[model samples]
Target: MMERTALISVNDLNIDVALRQAALGDRVLDLTPKGFDLLLFLAMNRGLVFNRKQLLEKVWGYDYAGDTRTVDVHIRWLRKKIEADPGKPKRILTVRSVGYKLEG
Candidate 1:
């Protein structure tokens, strides 16, 4: 069996990405594969600024030839689940015109 590498903990939430298990404040969060990947990438690189192109290359594992709207959509979805207030996000934050960063 392969060892699971992605381990994430946020407050009461503990998620094992390899096993696809997420516990959020005593409740289990249902996350899609893409969502899980995105969250794991940001959490692992906490406090680092990653532009859309970088995210596309790293997370998607190649240059995304598709629309960049995909990044925005996933970010929105991630914020909805992770942020206490998506409008005023304290975790995943937008860097104005630069990119997005995971706030530490």
Candidate 2:
């Protein structure tokens, strides 16, 4: 039997990640495909730090040839949609020069 995956919610922000549906809430936001994938990756591994390269390989596919800035851009986009204050993000956070971690 195949196990089913349920939605993952970050209740503090009233956000839900519907993995099978590839959506953030009751409806999908205007996030790009990559943005959704990036958010999904972080949400699935909440609180775990992942560097740009790791994210690219895991989320964007190992054959992806983009630079780390791509990850930054997607993270920025995610913040805008999910954060109450994008400037002072309370969810996804930077680790100086290391990378990022998702925290609710």
Candidate 3:
């Protein structure tokens, strides 16, 4: 059976992420194809850390030839839109040397 996609809100951020519409709350988020894919992946698997390489492969649909730093760049953009304070992120967290995890 096909499941309906619903809005995903983490914490009390007052924001809703609808993967179908690629939106964040009432405001439309202008995310790149890769950026959106990354966010959706993290959101679906919230609280679970995935390393850069893993994210790249899963989201990019292959083992990317690019550097893992791409994940950091996209994370930075996502925070600017979703995080209360992008500088000190709460929703998307950096797990030291491991990877990032969505704090759902």
Say which candidate scores most in TM-score. 1
What tens-digit string does per-residue lDDT give for candidate 3 at 28-68? 67777777777778887899999988888898868479888
The positional error of residue 39 in candidate 1, measured at the CA in angstroms, is: 0.3
Quote each prediction's TM-score: 0.83, 0.79, 0.79
Query: How do all the candidates rank in terms of lDDT, highest first?
Result: 1, 3, 2
* Most lDDT-accurate candidate: 1
lDDT of each: 0.80, 0.76, 0.78
Q: Between 1 and 2, whose TM-score is larger?
A: 1
RMSD of each: 2.7, 3.3, 3.3
Cα lDDT for residue 6, candidate 2: 62
Residue 39's lDDT in candidate 1? 77
lDDT of 1 by residue, 29-76 (tens): 678888877877887788889888888888887956987778888999
Candidate 2, lDDT over the whole model: 0.76
Stretches of model 2 off by over 4 angstroms after superposition = 1-5, 12-28
**What ordering of candidates by TM-score runs from best to worst?**
1, 3, 2
- Backbone clashes in model 3, listed as residue pairs: none
